[model samples]
Target: MVGWLLAGSMLAGACTASSPEVERAAPSGASEATPATEASSQPAAQGSVGRILEHLEALDRIAQRNGGTRAVGSEGYDESVAYVSRHMRQLGYSVVSDRFDFDYFEQLSPTRVERLKPRKAYVDGRDVRAMVYSGAGRVSAPVEPVGFDLRSNDHTGAGCSSDDFSDLPTGSIALLRPGPCYYRDQVVNAQEAGAAAVILAFPEFTRATGVLRPTLLSGAGIEIPALAATDGTGVELARSRTRLRITARTRYSPLRGVSLIAERREARAGDVLMVGGHLDSVMDGPGINDNGSGIATILEMARAVAAKEPDAPVRFAFWGGEEIGLLGSTAYVESLSSQQTTSIEAYLNFDMVASPNFVRYVYEDEIAPAGSDEITDLFTRYFNRQDIEFKTIDLGGRSDHGAFIEQGIPVGGLFTGAEMLKSRRQRKDYGGRAGASMDGCYHRPCDDIDNINQKVLREMVGAIRHALFALLTR
Candidate 1:
């Protein structure tokens, strides 16, 4: 089914930058942590970066030992929690597990794939499996494929339009392509057009579908079942006007998750440095590289700093239910007292810091935030130092960072890209191919230690170290 394994990888490409109105200059008399004066020293205050890596590797091994899925409420998730909790206890820092409950769902049936026309057309069952969230309901109408925009305001059936849909006879399904707007929106539009059902197609090859969870819903709020199918699915159904009977029962529900919070009171610097990664994943694959890379990077950074206790205490978290709807982070931030909100100086988030080719991107500024500007500049300087190439992208809340940006904190971070459809320009920028992506098995189970790029891992370690050192040591 359209599993969460591919979970939010599109978030990397789908991100939208928040407001840029906040002045970046350090207020004339504000207190802020400076860069580590001692990058070279094995300072106890900055948790042992090396040891933290070893610990992360251990967690990796243990998680791999269990099921591939490391979602917090699952077995793999529990193992990951145990790994981190054990390490935190040993580090001499105060640790508190903020427990919360969430409604959770696990897939039961294997994605059902069938062919009504034996030799004439074989169906790729995966499409029916995908778009499952927007995908639910049954369609017995002989599949009618129309290639065009599913216009707004109304629908009824194949070739139906806004006004056409209002009069459309019942039991009709409309199929749409991936453009013009959200895949979810296209489906909603079709259903609005009076379509009893809808099909949103994804790129054919990957056989994967992308999801869009807006704060709104269509179908008069009574959503007609919508599904994300492969573009190829439409093609096969078109080869012969065979009646294509389809049924997709997908679902998206509210799930509660847990988050851990720790406080180290540095002077009331009037700011907080926050770093974290989501702690949940879809039911199919193990979300290792998709996030193990990110979680490991932040935990290590926190452990290193907690050991020595930097000038300013850093708040490190491992969020839950991000795959579902950014639940954990959203809940935590939303629960904060409005008065307790503005104390953050900056938020430096890390997600998928390691990739095969390691093409780094700074997720913020033309010039990074002052809190992280030096670090961004340092990244460029480092690449220049190593004759490497990198790029900068707009700040986006596709990850846990979204929570902080909603709170108006200057946010930025390091990422090694996600299932990006590489461009011609990108092809010339690096190797593999201009159209080559960072990782194809982004949210899949194959994204384990082997999938990780060691060189990329090294770069992530360096980037995290530099940013933390600069934020806490200076």
Candidate 2:
């Protein structure tokens, strides 16, 4: 087992704590740092926080030049791929680009929900929402409440069986509540009943007054339109003699997303240390903090590693289509050969590492492979040596790491926080607003360059750098 050596503080900040012992095994065929590797480590200034910020500024400009977002299926994301590929080639690393197909969706115009009988227009995106895979069209038809007790919140057998839709009219929209069965089943039932459309009524207890949660189902074959309605609107449609009109102008089409892979020139052996971050932003924002932070960190580290080329292979992957799902990473893993999968010793993922209101979070990987503990320990020891506080979060397949974990690869990562509200104790530990979300602008239009916390960004860079150095030197 190789052990981390502690001695002094880093360029970013102070270190006061006593060193703690942690054991990590050397990778297969790993060697001690050569003269070139030693020289490369000394030029750590190449990967400084300032350089990372420059890259971030460039990404922001790229987004601005495009459609103000680096989301998949947008020109901004294509330019981002070009940018990363160009930089890696200039750094003398051989770059590879892989493209994959994905379903691209966009809400083209404001959705409309109206009660024809009462002649009222409810708010769009709030009181009503068009489910993801809903067919794009307008339907003005009678509202036929189906399934168990439409007036009650306790929907016992709502839309679970075909019998529920037997009496439903063909030219009407079926109103049903979510119940015991999968939503897909309920939707299928409604479609088989020859209903013109389907409306899912929210239960009274749904806290967000008018906000409709987006659905994940792709609703592949069922062509009829589907919509979600708030409890108040639902109640009005159910009890009162009502006819409703729903319109959703949405575009669903195919788009190709690219993931960039760069390998250091000197690396020859298949045993690899892989690091990655998703490069795509959500459609609503620039995604500077959600992922730009992580991509910047990895790019800078790749620059540093290139400067001090090592014999062991280091793969730097910038994935696409992560905002929609882990599509890019999943495709990459699926494309890999069995030999290639086994060749990867470990994967370190960095996502949302620089939230505006931040916490130092490391992926715990409680049920992970043996190497996962070592990966977590590396970050832990580095933070300890720097006198920084950090917390461990369960790796519950929330990011690209899920793809690697699915292949039984030891995966670990870092995330500051997302939409989850921080606790009082976290506030005391991180010196941020306890009651508010760690990142207030998560997945919103406001997540521009200004959303990054430079202090945390620098610290995160420092910690990641330390961990990479340890990995290479081990």
Candidate 3:
């Protein structure tokens, strides 16, 4: 999931409650505060990073054995589901899979871009990649500049406005550049302009590694074919006088994802506290840090919590299809009845918790559900007591928490970082490169076990354990 900037006032000393009130403590128990040192050194907490590394290694193996990815509908993802569910069952929890259908995309053939007039074909993976949600088709037409004119050497942000299409030729592929709008908006504008297709040429700064890495449009919908081109290819296409032939074809079919849910044995029927993380990864990589870290941490907490089975029920959810959007989580939330919805005391999400270049982040919702502020405070206080620096960032509608928030269920979570670059201040606080992305390998194939920061993983996992201990024991 993409990251968003912080917003709203910092959570104050208290927050408003919006959901049904949960009993302060289970009928059979009274909550007690435990020190971090004591909470983290327990047997269950031993080798937190070691255990996380093991899961990361296992996920890497699954990806290696099954086409190098654990993406939804793939064997790797299925095996991953089985792995998590099997372990939860062994730990004496009732495990179940929630199945859902999502629009699945697979490239039928390598996408190609040829400058017919110039008689040159750019390298496929290096120079261009078909946009993940682009339509399956082949088109041969003149490449008309839309957002920026080559001769003028000026960016008009053309595709962002419909007026830019005034003199556009029908049946020509529109060429655009990254600017003030989303790729979807550009594509939609081009589609409305009678353009047969669209190509978004990356600016020099975005051409990391000089490759046109594939980009995706929200699976929500798109009718025209779109492709991402390297800056060099864009320049070449723009200067070439002849038409271009773009062939892009992808197979669209039904894809199934399974979310594993485990509830402690014979717990109370009152408010349920749901803790979850997405288990599925992007198509290109093993996704160790993007989500493997979150799941592994949650799994550890689940096992420890199960060993001491409390009166209040706790549900652990390992969501699927989060990479495409919050499909799995959304489906689960939509399945719940109004009563079931209210029965959920609070929801905590953990995604990308262990980026190599990391910063400890707690999701802070200014206007949040009933127990969200408490959750944030729990994390903040834990880090503070440990002398570890942390920050409260806006949730930004990015992960599984989004689904719960949509239903007015209080939600909070942790995120080390994704693609966002770290500032000088954050670097000083976190001790990482100031200009680098917190998770440089995010969504890339290199996000294997080696991409994790063991120290960050250990601290984050310890905090996760502390939070769970607080929720279950309280």
Candidate 4:
């Protein structure tokens, strides 16, 4: 149970020979192709990723003046789980915020998008954003503009090529326009995209996050449901050519986040460098860099690599409702136990590695495991031996190291994107604007701390403290 369960440490790199069974529910632009490094080894070699992005910008100024972080079941997520279990028990180690009790939600008010009949209208949630598991009450129906309302890729029935919806009917309300899937693949592709209920517009005028606003319709077998809207209410229901009647009334409540599994026993523990982030955020936005810069770079690199002295025994995690879907690193790697998943060997992740237009990429997944290709060849050999500028993307599925890469774990790290889309090769290597979105305040509420970029959050905390001081010191 607590043994090193290795299905490749729950699938990390080499992505376990292409694994993509089923997990597409949280995907809405997460920008970053990679480029930008060297935020340390200067000004006094500042150590541990510049002392962990100044504690991930002071937990992004305490979720930008309180509200954007520690969000799982509020009390600002149990006071950010007693501020990372009192900073990993003051660095001595042995901390655990692990107290599982999910079914928490908060957005107490505002989420009404009516537009009944041949006239009348409204919409909010800071304009248009709702998709956490989205499915509650109040819906008048009659609308079905199905352009890209996606359930998972229904480009609109017998036309968008086809995944078939048996010819959409029964109370028709399905409509979509977000892609690359997940959000229950637009609610199982709008109930198989045949539609009878669904509405998720946002082809252009973007920026949103809201959905999963339920009150228990079904659980265990999990079916969250869908009922969203925006794209300026689909540009006022496409200037109303009539037929509109969509009502909306999403209120939410499903809180309970507690993930903390601390271990620091080095005496040559070797090949077991797993890190963590996601101290629950996304409610009035307390997610500093979409993860308070991955729990301030794994709690200040688990207090500077357990005080710069460890050859392995570094497992400082602190996840809980990783904004909903990575459900605490996939329920702690699906509660591991397959021959203890092969006495693990590699898994160095640091979700949302400090933000501010992060680049200096990695994760090509080159059959990943020679200890994570010697850790992305040591950040592609320290950003091409310090010439700086990054980009290497390709290992899809976003974060919690994609649940130890779905159960194989030979993964890698460094991310500064969310709600992504900035290309043209990331504006010719981290230049900004070639399609803008390296986190345009990712989970909105203006992803606070004045939407960071402090030199791309100091080269994403010096390429994650020089890739954890070269993978936990050799």
For TM-score, the strongest prediction is 3
Off by over 4 Å in 3: 2-46, 116-121, 148-167, 177-186, 201-205, 209-223, 230-242, 310-312
Model 4, clash count? 72
Between prediction 3 and prediction 4, which has the larger lDDT? Answer: 3
Query: Which candidate's lDDT is highest?
Result: 3
Residue-level error in angstroms, candidate 2, position 75: 0.8
**lDDT, candidate 3, residue 382?**
69
What is the descending TM-score order? 3, 2, 1, 4
lDDT of 3 by residue, 111-225 (tens): 8888876488866666887765677788999988765667665443457677878788999998877645556667777888898888877643244643423334354557777
Q: How accurate is candidate 2 locally (lDDT)?
A: 0.72
TM-score per candidate, in order? 0.75, 0.78, 0.84, 0.33
User: Which stretches in model 1 have alpha-carbon errors above 4 Å?
Assistant: 1-66, 99-103, 113-128, 132-138, 144-169, 179-196, 204-225, 235-242, 249-255, 265-270, 365-375, 381-387, 422-434
lDDT by residue for model 4 over 1-474, one digit each (tens)? 000001111222212222222212212322333333233433323454566566666666666556555567667767767777877777777765555556554444555555557466455554454454455545555665544333433322221223534456655666554433333444565655445455555433343433212112212322323544545565456455245443333445445567887876443644456677667776656666777766766776666666666445567788877665567777777776875555555676666654555554566554444456667666655555455666565445455676776677777876655554566655676677756556666655767656666665555555666776666655
Clashing pairs in 3: none
What value does the lDDT take at residue 260 in candidate 1? 68
List all candidate RMSDs to the true structure. 7.0, 9.7, 7.2, 19.6
Quantify all predictions' global Cα lDDT against the true fold: 0.55, 0.72, 0.73, 0.55
Better of 2 and 3 by TM-score: 3
